[model samples]
Target: MTVASKDVGMMTMIENGNEVKRTCCSSNSGCGSSEILVEYAGNEKWIQGVINTPKGVVPVVSTQLNFSDILGSWKARWGVNRMNYKINPGLYAVGTPDNESPVLVTANYKSTFDSLRKELADINTWILVLDTKGINVWCAAGKGTFGTKELLTRISCTKLHEIVTQRTLILPQLGAPGLSAHEASRQTGFQVVYGPVRAKDIKEFIRRDMTATPEMRTVKFTTYDRLVLTPIELVEAIKVSIIAFGILFLLNLIVTIPFGLDDFYAYVGALIIGCVITPVLLPWIPGRAFAWKGWLLGFIWAVVVNLINGWPQLPSYSLVRAIGYLLVLSSISSFYAMNFTGASTYTSSSGVIKEMKIAVPIIIITVSLGMLLILLNSFMGI
Candidate 1:
């Protein structure tokens, strides 16, 4: 069989005792394709047989990262191609592996799968991907999709015990949140092993006799990692255009001149400040809670807006409109910050609940007051 796409090219041949590979050559002798001959188990089933009724077709057991996978990763960052960007939830072989090869388990999220397989390019292993609904391991564990139940279920469904000689299964460290190691061993009879925090360290972990270094045990969210998430947040904020457009329409009706664009710009600016800038600059921003950090940024931006509008005096615009912008814009920023607590690290469920109880009520009150003031100024001809 021959497989070709814009990003990848490959040919496959499965045969008897002799190694099988197709040498790709054009009419000319300019280009030559090297034959990759892997000696696989004759008793083992076809590479495709591992799929069963899995959602995705198994890509001919490869460790090389495809250009298409990198492209898919770019799309996932912007929240595009996120839902279907996943591998089939089942057992798979990285290269030709005997029963003694180590078994590694991971989430079906394509990026995570690619990262793991890419690091183990030279090492032959069994990869058992769980159905995490396309979420990364950490988030999936938090949501319970990467829990002990699904792990045991997949193990049973795939008949893993019958395939591999060893009863040890290595899992990503992030998946520990929802998994009870003892409970899993008690039920499945397979020993659970938590591997390194990052895929890059997996090779080292295995080479050092399945031992993870202290550095590998720690999880760190760097600035770049934090920055990438802002794009998705900004895009998600755009989905609330209905309410924003409604408010803009009302503002257009109230003002005789073209103040609609000004108000709209201010609205969009608030979104940028809240969703994009707030999270990107989270560490530098002052305040323990996300709400206050957002509010501070919003208040500062509101002041800048006021200065642009001639802070001291206004001929046509009322004091209420000026005050209204300050209150409303700051509140919008604060709301975005409060909602973003889930995306940040070291935040507890009970702490988030505690913050929401206090922050939500205050945001509601401030926003309502700002809107009322703007309407009252419009009606009274201020």
Candidate 2:
């Protein structure tokens, strides 16, 4: 049984292309459509309606994303409201699904949920959302928020046994790291089925008796995939750049060190190389370690900076300052490039740790020495 819902509040919000008002109403079976109108008219608007069942009322959601959903996703990509961008972690209905419908599990991250549902435009399925603390499936799985414990607890809380007749729960393949299939099945009486790495393949996966092709299972981190993630990394790098720039500016005011346009250009160039260039050219870069790739590019950029300033030929230029520029630029680029380890699937946790052990000390020593040389050059006329 289902009750159609209408927008009762005067609050203006855009859905699809048209402006519409939204209202908050609990999907509990006790409340009628009329009673819901006057109960509580606040500003929560994600759920469209409800489907009453033997267990409880499951909130119905649209497969199509609205204007607000689109805006929120864009804001999240830029690191704005990133942690807060999530839906309520619970069972939801897409289209008019029955107890026999397949259950697809995913994280509560709004972007992940949006990606899953948008591809299910023609499919009628029940979505089981796990509380991943606004993290995507792959990350949350690594962090353990989307682990076996959370899955068992959510299944019990949602009374999934009563809501659906199926004994299988389809989970994203990336989330496999955290969940032990046998353990979850033992605890919840539901077998786990691993789905495709990408959400777009969900339709085909389901159409083929819940089996995924080899292509569907394969995870590809293409250039476009790496490119989209750069914005957030760049945004974080910019914050650090502001602090570094201020410190350099203060040094110029207090000391005789020549910190000017050349220095600023070199810093920004290194920042870009680390946060954007390294990721975009990841496959083509000569080294296995991201830090090494970034350092090489940053070193080249530092050379360009020196060339622009007419190094060696210029009588006033100090070799100490020139060497310092190379070290600082390369180190800064290496640090930022290492930050991409969390965002990429190319490196394992152990590999990242090993790289850090070898790279971090060198970076610290070189940067410290570089800064000392830059300051020492001012005093000794090196």
Candidate 3:
């Protein structure tokens, strides 16, 4: 069959103990053909051909590579610190696709492909990888890079029409913003079918014949999901934590009597309690705002400190100093907890900004007043 330059051609041939011969010749050749031969083993089901180009001849795979192997190789090459090499975003074939196999569409990002394949073990499907420039589908769709135009262009470039018999292509639900379903069908013969929001749900979605219920479309931020993000947050917060703790410790040492190691530890503990623990346990801490939750946790920490350190029973000046430290620590912790909303998916950007504006001033005022009161109490010998 003669395939168009913009078409990807799929052919099935049967051979009986002899190699099938074929030739490819460009129109530029005076003989009207460049002599090339395709040797198909008698048992071989398919053969791939590549047209030499300026850069190099690119290999065209007739059979799909194992999805797990593809994903594993990608992770090995690009996982942790190898961020320099940009991922290739374009059409890729997954599994051994026959003319009738289901076509699954995905973003070009290696990570996104890995996620989809890793979750879809034992499933025989064709993956039509779209060029999204290394971004996930949700973000790419929002940026319009994964929009209808690219989809149509890719379909033409890959000659997907020649490979699959069906006229349907499965896309991720999050990509709906950038795709015009009606326009896609008009531009390309293929009709668009939006899949589930998450790749993990694809198996079940396919079982249900590509129909996504409301539950499949919804995005949830459960505690476990939130907790998975904590490590990154902790790593990012380390620099700020160090500077804040150093300043607070110095203040504690200078304002109080002979500098003690215990005082330094207490100040450090307050920093962690406020910045880390408070944010994680935010919802259960009895307040709608993160600052209030931090304050509540801080108050509890103070009570525990008073009991353990016997600070309440200390001399008047020392008791006052202890109270000052606890109050300031609590205020700081609560304030930092409020910053967590920015990283949370559940919190809107506007809501986070609003919380920060209101909470920051309260934290500053309370911590400042607590420090000032302690100094005055020390001077008055109260």
Return the top candidate by TM-score: 2
User: Could you say which candidate leads in lDDT?
Assistant: 2
What clash count does candidate 1 reach? 0
Using lDDT as the measure, what is the rank order of every candidate, best first?
2, 1, 3
Candidate 2 stretches greater than 4 Å from native: 1-46, 379-381
Give the per-residue lDDT of model 1 (tens digit) for 285-329.
987788888989998887777777777565345777778878989
Which 10 consecutive positions of candidate 1 have the poorest summed lDDT? Answer: 30-39
Write candidate 2's Cα lDDT for 157-204 as tens digits: 566788789899999999999888888878779989899999999999
Decreasing TM-score order of the candidates: 2, 1, 3
Across 188-277, the per-residue lDDT of candidate 3 in tens digits comes to: 788899899888898899899889999999877667655654554455556676786576566666553433565456655665666667
In candidate 1, position 84 carries an lDDT of 69
Which segments of model 1 are wrong by more than 4 Å?
1-60, 254-259, 313-316, 378-381
The alpha-carbon lDDT assigned to residue 124 of candidate 1 equals 75
